[model samples]
Every structure is written in C-alpha cells, then in structure tokens.
Target: MVVSLKESDFFSKNRRALAKWISAVEDRLPEGLEFLQRHYHRVGHAFRIGITGPPGGGKSTLINALLRVFRARYPEETIAVVAVDPSSHLSGGALLGDRIRMDAIGLDEGIFMRSMASRGSLGGVSEATADICDLLDIYGFDRIFIETVGIGQLELDIISLAHTNLLVLSPECGDEIQAIKSGIVELVDIFVVNKADRQGAGRMVNDLEYMLGLRVYSGEDWRPAVVSCVATGGSGEGADGVFELVEKVESHRSWLQARGRWGRKNRRNLERKLRQNLFHYLQREFDFLQPLLEQKAEEVEKKRLSFSEALEILLEEFSRQFSSSLKKRKGG
Candidate 1:
C-alpha cells in the first residue's frame, strides 16, 4: 500500500497529492523526509502567518474570517491553512478538528486546510508543524496560515516559525490578560482583541496599549500593533473588524519588507529548524545506547559511581562504538 509518488505528482496542482504528502510528513515516513530533501529549495516563497492565543479567544473564528477576506482580496492566489488542535487523550487525534469548524467556508478550490493534533507538545504546535508548512510552501501556496493550539502564555514557539505572529485575545479573558502580559507581549507582532462587541473590549485594548508603552523594545523598532475584531460576517449582524485586522497584518508584512528583516527572520527560522532536526536525528541514530545509559543510571543509584564519573565512562563507550561504526561503514 506504500506506493511511491512521482516527482511530477508532487509538483502538479492536485489536492489529493498534497494531502498524501502531508500525511506522510505527519507520520514521519522515510518518503516524507526524502520529499523534503528533494524539494526544500521550493520553500521560502510562501508567507507564513501564525495565529495563537488563550483558549476561547476565537482564534479559529478569526482565521475563518481572515481566509474569506484574503480570498476576496486576492482571487488569483492560493492559500493553505494548518490548524493545530489539542490531542484526544484516547486516540491522540485532534480533539477539536478545525476542518469541521471551518466548514462554513465550504470547499473553496483556492484554499487548502489541514488539522493536526498537538501530540502533547508544550510549544502549542505539533513537532511536524514546520515540516507540514514547508510541504505546503513547496506545493506553491502563496500564503500559509498556522493556527496554534490555544495554550495561552506558553505558546511562544510560534515566534520561531512565523513571519508575522498574531496573538488573538478577547474581552472574556479578563484577568487572564494580566497573566499573558508578562511573556506573550514580547513575541507578538499584533495583538488582536476579538469579540469586540463585548463590554470590556475597549478596556482590554487600552490595557494592552498601556502595557506596550511601558515595555522597552530594546534595539527593535517595530512596535506591536493592537486591533479589535468580531471575527464574524462582514455585515451589520456582526462587527466586521476582521478587515482592519487583516490590514494591520499586511502593514506588519510591509514593515518587515521595508526594513529588510524578512529574509533575516526566515534565515533564523531555518537555522532553528535545522538544529531541531539534528537533535531528532541524533536521538534516532543513538537509540542503541539506551541500555548502556540505564546501566550507568543504576551504577549512580548504587553509589558505585558519581554522575560525572558515569557520564565520562558512557562518553568513552559512545566514542568507541561510534568510531567503530563509522570505520565499518567506510570500509564496507
């Protein structure tokens, strides 16, 4: 059942092909890494925007509205969405699948949406999120939206993966906003107050503005902008602040471009990605050392060796084994 897809199949504008590739990547199959190795050069063209916030902040609804606005504004361009949801305890699948929530948008041919389970990652995104986004980028989507599992203050990893980061907050958050101000404030590019029709919406925005004023930007010049939105329809039935929200996001993009920081940020993202992948690669390659590690741990537990002494013995063994394997591989 594991059929190898042709290179053309990946490059062709077929949704089915893209879905297959995404599945492979998420599952961490060898084919997925091979595909990435082959076509990674096709990346860096797509603009990645990350949306994250506290639970019940309407992040999903805001993303839905933003999709509509983007589609209308740029009909010729294609868009991709990667929504990360908390994992189900039993099955480890997405608990609140965004594909269902975004069904109101229907199946627009110009848009691609995929939902992923966070898989217990504390970073608010799954380990494979960046890889999936790279696949979407190589698939030729002009814009990619990454919606994180809403874990409030701990979702700072989005800063490393996205070009523009939007932190969606709501009036309902109340005192929770104070908890977020200490950490999330520094990473966000735009602070979006959704449910702007609510009573405390204005106060929330003002409080955020005041907090921004007190913080020093260090050497950075671009101050995070605060905006309000209802994240519903554009009609009078719901406040249409999403339009302004989109404008602010675009403005941030322009600012990044004008200051020539876009490429620099992208480079940093790649560097971090490379380092993460390297760590995983080493873990997989050295899994055979687990027994030796356990033995060392037992020696330390018995007081036969100190931690440093155990570590030194383990390092010698590791070096000897690794060097022997390298010689064997070269000789063969």
Candidate 2:
C-alpha cells in the first residue's frame, strides 16, 4: 500500500521525507513519480510562467525580482522556481549557479527553489521541467516560474511549456539586428531588456522598437512588447510588464493552434524522458553511451566501420533495449 502523507507530515515532522520526495520528483523516478500523480490533485492550481533568453541575459536575476513582487502582491501565495540549465562543464553534472543567482528570494520561506541540471540532455532544456511545473502546480504553488538555459536556438523549447514566454535580452548582447531574427522574434512573448542601466540600453530599445514597427505593419494581431529591467538591482528588472510594455495575451486563432501544441508536445516530452530511462537501463546512467561512442570513434579511425554503420548499431541497441525496458515495465 502507498504511504499517505498528511499535512502534519509535511510540517517539519517529516521534513526529510518531503525533501526526498521532491528530489525524486525532480529526477523523474518512476516509483517516486506515482506519489506525485496520486497527490497531483492537491497541487493542481498554479500559473506557470516561462522565462528564457541567451546566456547572461539576466533571466535568473529577473526571476528573482518577479518572485519578490509576487510575494508582496499576493502575500498568501506560494511560489516555486525550476531552473533548467546545463551542468557546469567543470562541475561534472550540476548547475553553474542556482543558489547564487537566486539569492534574492532563496532565503524566503514562501519561495522554493529547485535546480535541475540538463546533464547533457539537449534541446536546451531540462527533461523534467514541464512535468515538474505540473507537479508544482498540483502541489499548490500559486506561481511556477521556469527558467531555461539561454544558449543557441534550442532554448526556445520553453515556449511550449509556459503560459507566458518572457524572452530576456541583455542590453549589451552581441548585435541589435538579432532582434529581427525570425526564430527569436516569433516565439518571444515579452521582450525584456535586462541590465538597462548599461550604456546600450537606449540603443537596444530603439532597435527593438524599429523591429516591432515592421512587425506591427504585418497582419499579426499579437504585438510583442519591450520592457527594460535592471535585474542586478533586483528592482524593476525582469519586470517587463511594469512599464505598460506588456503583451496583452489575447486568444489568437493561430496561437490557439500554436498553444494547443502542448498536448502533442507533452507526449513527445514524455517519450524523451522514457528514452532517458531506457538508456539508463542499458548503461546504468552515463557509462554505456560514452564508451560506445568512444569505440565508434576508434572503429572509424581504423576504417573498421563508417560513422553511419556505428550510428546504426547504436540505434539498434537502443531499440532493443527500449523494447526490453517496456517489457520490464509491463511485468513490474
């Protein structure tokens, strides 16, 4: 029988149990996941907001600021932040900084901070981010904030998982022209100019204005707004909506189809987690794949096999292992 945790159990009496439960949930363990699903109904009422941008865009600082506002405005509300970032190359498999960046709100008893390392999973996201959001939502968090890695084009995946996609940009980001890039412009809901006290803040705002003008002329009804923030100050930073520069979320026909993609998207996301599980079964975490990849490299070096042939073997092994994993799950 499943052990039922009561409210008293959550209040210091069973603190360690709660911690382990949360850890298990973040890791996406199958056994621990059941507790979440069974109790999800208790946690199913929260708004999920997604914040993403390029590296050093001040997303962490901005999120920290947002949490302060939320706490003051809605004093009774509970908030949770899930930071999805790659493992620091030097640190092996841990976030570059979660406690440091989130120092603004981490100490708050009302705010809960959780960092999920990408651990080499690609697509610029944490595999469990959305699921964790859902779990936090059901767990009674009033607001759930998801912070994505700001690297390359892959980070945009946060759009499918969040109700609001706040695309944060640093005032000094490489070039102003990047604002008009099709892929970046389309997915961003709110354009936040973080580190606004910096020199390029005005120029960055002007460049964005020019870009938005071109977009306004288009038949698109949804107009993305640009907001300035000084995230380091922890004031109006990441406060993209503070200056009336907020994207009015209207129900768009196209966007509905776009937003509706979540259902299908979640399915694919679950499949990815499943694949991670299958790989873990085959290799016991990181051992199998890297060694196999290394062997493939050696084979290629000696002309023993082509890269395609090596890839085929890997795929075949994955398929075989995946089928076996499914059977184990069935038997379990």
Candidate 3:
C-alpha cells in the first residue's frame, strides 16, 4: 500500500516523509500530484545542476568529491542528489551502482540521495527526474544535482532541467571529443574533464579549447568552460582540481543571473513540461480512437481508401465523438 502524508508533515522536514513522497510521485499516485499542485510555489528556489557523460568517466567519484566540497563550503545549506541509473533489460530495475561510491557523502545529515532507474528512457534521464527534482526543490534544498545515466553525444535532455549542465569527460576522450563536437558542444555550459591525473589529460583540455575557438561567440554569450579534475581515489582524496571546477560552475551561474537568462531558462523548462503534460492528457482523452485508427489502417492496407482519405475520416470521427463525449459529460 502507498503511504500518504499531510502537507504539514511534509513541511516539517521529515526525511522519511520526503522519501515516501518521492516514491508516490515516481509511481504517479494521485496524492503525489495533489501535493505538487498544492506546494508548487515552493519550487524555483533550488539551483539544479545536471551532470552527464559517457561510462567510466569517473562521474560518480567526481560527484562524491563535489558533495564533500559543497558541504564544507555551504555548511548550513541542504543538498539533494538524484542519480539516474540504467535499468535492467529483464527486470527493468536499476542496480544504482553510483550510490555505493557516494556512500561517504550520503552519510551527511544535510545531504540526501536518491537513485532512479532510467527504465528504457533513451535520453539518459528518467521521465520522473524533473518532477523528483522539483520535489527536492520544494523540500527547500539549496542545491540539487541530477546525474544522468551514462549517455552518448546526442542525449542532451538534461539541458531542459538543469540551470547549469556539466558534461564530464576523461583523458581518454579524444574520440569522444570528435563524436560530440557537433551536438554536446553547443548545449553544455561546462565541460568537466575528470581523471586529469591520467596521461593525455592536457591534450584533451587543449582539444576542447581549440574546439571552442571553432565556434563563433559574441561578447554576451556564455562560452562553455572546460575544467580538468583528478576526481579518482577515495571520496575526497583527489579533490585538487574540483575547486577550480566549482569556481567555474559558479561563474557560469553568475553569468546566467546577471544577464537575466536564469528566469528565462526556468520558464522555458516549465513550458516544456506543460507541453509534455498536455500531450499525455490528450493521449488519454483520445484513447478511444484506437479501434477507429486500426480500422482505418486496415482500409489503407486493403486499398479500400487512400491514406489521406482514411486519416481525414479518422479526424472527422474523432471530432464528432469528442463533441458527443463532452456533451454527455456536461449533461447536454
């Protein structure tokens, strides 16, 4: 059975309550939607940061180091992490291996971590990721980190939810640099070259810089910064370059706020969510058209009707049935 919590109980800062709410939201429970509708005003406060990269880029270790640094830097601030892991083909469940590496930082009282299964979402983020982030934001977390499942060059969905997006790469990313130059370069605000202690790290940095030079940027545009980090070893051992990386991230954040683009980005992201919700709602409302669609498809296949004519017929039937349904609901 799903558990439900009162708004007051949720606001009282109970972590277990918060965790239960996350589960409800992920499951799309009615109470979860109700809570979101009630307290949506509490959102838009947390700074959501997205981190993505190819597999074996040391992203988990980097995040572990980041949590330590962030905790020390902002002692009073609460932090939340939503790590999206790839789902199993057989069970559709995630191993959530990232949490193991993050255990040290997870022990901090001010920090909260949740692992989510991508569940066949090719974009590297789960469908509920944005909503989960909003929940964490409403919970009054000062900062939220969304780590995507290992992704390729074109899986750039993180941009919609992230105020600042970091694409983590490593010293062995020479080929990766070439592969993602066309797509990822344009969207990323920061290119984090993790495992900077490895050989060819300097070359990778230079390569990224040279690639940046290839793009034409005006004085006002935010050019993506490439920072190298040796984010190997234990939780906090190789945090040497992370300080600079954090500084660069902060600079980008400041740039966004100074130029008045911060709010605009959030608005755009909200618009995207609205559109997605509308699409889902329409799909549910028009689900009764499935039989007609199948019949029309059969007609087309049998050459009894042209494709365009069949589609027109379906649309007309859809309009008529939709009107009838609305009238019946309205007691007409």
Candidate 4:
C-alpha cells in the first residue's frame, strides 16, 4: 500500500515531525508531497543570512561567534543553523564536523542546528536544503543561518539563498593589489578581513577600499562595508558592530528584490528535481519493457524501430496501467 501524508492521522505539526516531513519530501514521498503545495507560504518568515568563505578562513569560528551574539540579543527567539559540508568523493558521505565544533551552542534550548552533506550538488547543499529551511520556518525559528561548504565557486550558491551575504576573507588574502580574491567578492554585502593581527592585513584592507571607491551605486542602500577582525581573539572591536549596519540597510523593499531572485532560482531548482523524479518513476514503470530498448541485432535490430514509435508504445503502456488502476479502485 502507498503511504498517504494527508489521509493518514499523522502529527506533522510537531517540530521533529516537520523535520521528518521535509526528509520525506526530499525523497519525493507521495504521502507528504500534497502538504507542501498548500502550506509552503506559511513556512517562510525567518530572516535568512548565508555565511561563506574559502576553507581555513575561520568561517566556523565566525559562525560560532555570530550565534553567541544573536542568541544574547534575542532571549525569547530560537535560531536555526544549517551547516553544509560536501560529500567525500571516495566515501559518498560527508565528513562534516561543524556539529562537533558547535557543541556548546546546541546544548541551549533556543538553538537548533543541523548538518547536511552536499551530496555532489553544486548549487545547493542538497536539492532539499531550501525545502528543509521551509520546514524549520514552520517550526517557528526566526533567524536562519546557512553556512556553505567552502568548495570552489560554491559560495555563490549559498549567497543566493540568503538575504544578506557576508564574504569573509583575511588581510593577507590579497597582496599589494589584494591578489588573492574572495570567491564571492562582487556580491558581498559585508566584507570581513579576519585575522587582522597578521602582517599585510592593513594593506589588504586598503586595496579592497580602493576597489570599492571605484564602484558605482545609485541605490539609497549604502555600499557594502569592509570590516577587519580576528575571529579567534575577538579582535577588531568594531567588527561586531557591522551586523547592525547590515540590518538597517535591508528594508522590505530590498528584501522583496532579493526574494524575487530567490523565487526564480527556486523555480529552476524545482523543475530540475521534478524532471529527475519523473525519470526515476518512469524507469520503474517501464521495467518490463527494458528488453525492447536492448533488442538484439538479428531480429528487431534490422527492424530499426523509430524513437517516435518507441515513445508511442511506452505512452500506451502507461495509459493502460493508469486506466486499469482507476477501474479497479472504482469497482471496490
């Protein structure tokens, strides 16, 4: 018997249950799929911020620090963090230990953290991360933080999902000309030069400022700010102050524009997932017809069956199956 999400007496309203519901959606669970179409709008209220930088740039430390800062400020609200680490090619599982490093925060009642394996997805961690965020939103988390796996060009993927994108770099990243570029430098809403105590950091900041000065921005929103800091020692006393500046600039109009972009991206992502799932379902439906595709040289190989004819036969086969199932249900 096929599982049905809506018809069954299930407690999908619970937080953990909702999370499980999202996992079901990830696998294209027919039972849980109906709820998503009707309730998706109700599940999106949190302010999403994406954190991304090159590996070894202290991204985890920065995220840890932000959690502390945000938690202290909002005593009544819960925060949800989604950390993504790419799967190891050899093992096909993630070696993600953001959970290990973030143990202290998870102990709190107000924080919920999850780690996702990239699963070879280049754009989003899983094709389901966005949907997973929607699940968390329905559970009542107000601030959503997504930390991207610091793989090459993957930073772009993370920023696209967030309202405010912070590009974390170091003072030594670029030489005199700031040669070593951050992956998503152009899209940065805030540029952080972490580990400022090191040499050449000062020059790095200057080079970034030089580049920013040449940029043209006619929008009322201020140009992206570059802040320098040491994530380890609480360096750059002013570094913590930059976040408020980011918030002030992100008005509803700005947010709507960002969501419009996200909406288009979501459409593309959904289409891709639908096509993949459709192909999988089709393969199972046509298992008995596999021999037709693998027909041997002597008999049907010489017949040279046209592609159009094969499609026609497959359509008829599925139509028959569907019609038969409907008739059987009606008879009962």
Q: Which of the predicted structures, 1 or 4, would earn the higher lDDT when compared with the native?
A: 1
Q: Per-residue lDDT tens digits of candidate 4, residues 97-194? A: 55677643867878877777777776646656766676677667888888888753435466445666776666545532344354345566776676
Candidate order by TM-score, decreasing, is 3, 1, 2, 4
- Give the runs in model 4 whose Cα sits over 4 Å from its true position: 1-15, 152-154, 175-186, 234-332
Candidate closer to the true structure by TM-score (higher is better), 2 or 4: 2
All predictions: root-mean-square deviation over Cα? 2.9, 5.7, 2.9, 7.2
- Candidate 4 vs. true structure, TM-score: 0.66
Error of 1 at 54 (Å): 1.7
Which stretches in model 2 have alpha-carbon errors above 4 Å? 1-18, 40-44, 88-93, 101-103, 152-154, 176-181, 215-221, 232-324
- Which candidate leads the pack in TM-score? 3
lDDT of 3 by residue, 1-332 (tens): 64667777778999999989998888788889888888899899999899998887878888888888888888999999999888988876677754876764656899998988888776877777888999999999999999988865535568778999999988776688878856668789999889888899999999999999899999989998999888754435456688888888789889989999899989988887777666656676689999989998999999999999998998898789878878996899
lDDT of 2 by residue, 1-332 (tens): 35444444444434355555566666667755886667655643565677877777878877777777667666898888888777877754556656575765755778877777776656566656656676666556777888877774426557656655677787667464464476678666677788888888889888887887776434434566678767656344445443332222222223535656435434554565567556545666335467787888899899999989998987877677667767887995
Instruction: Output the TM-score of candidate 1.
Output: 0.88
Worst lDDT 10-window in candidate 4: 3-12
Q: Give residue 27's error in model 2 in angstroms.
A: 3.0
- What are the models' TM-scores? 0.88, 0.69, 0.88, 0.66
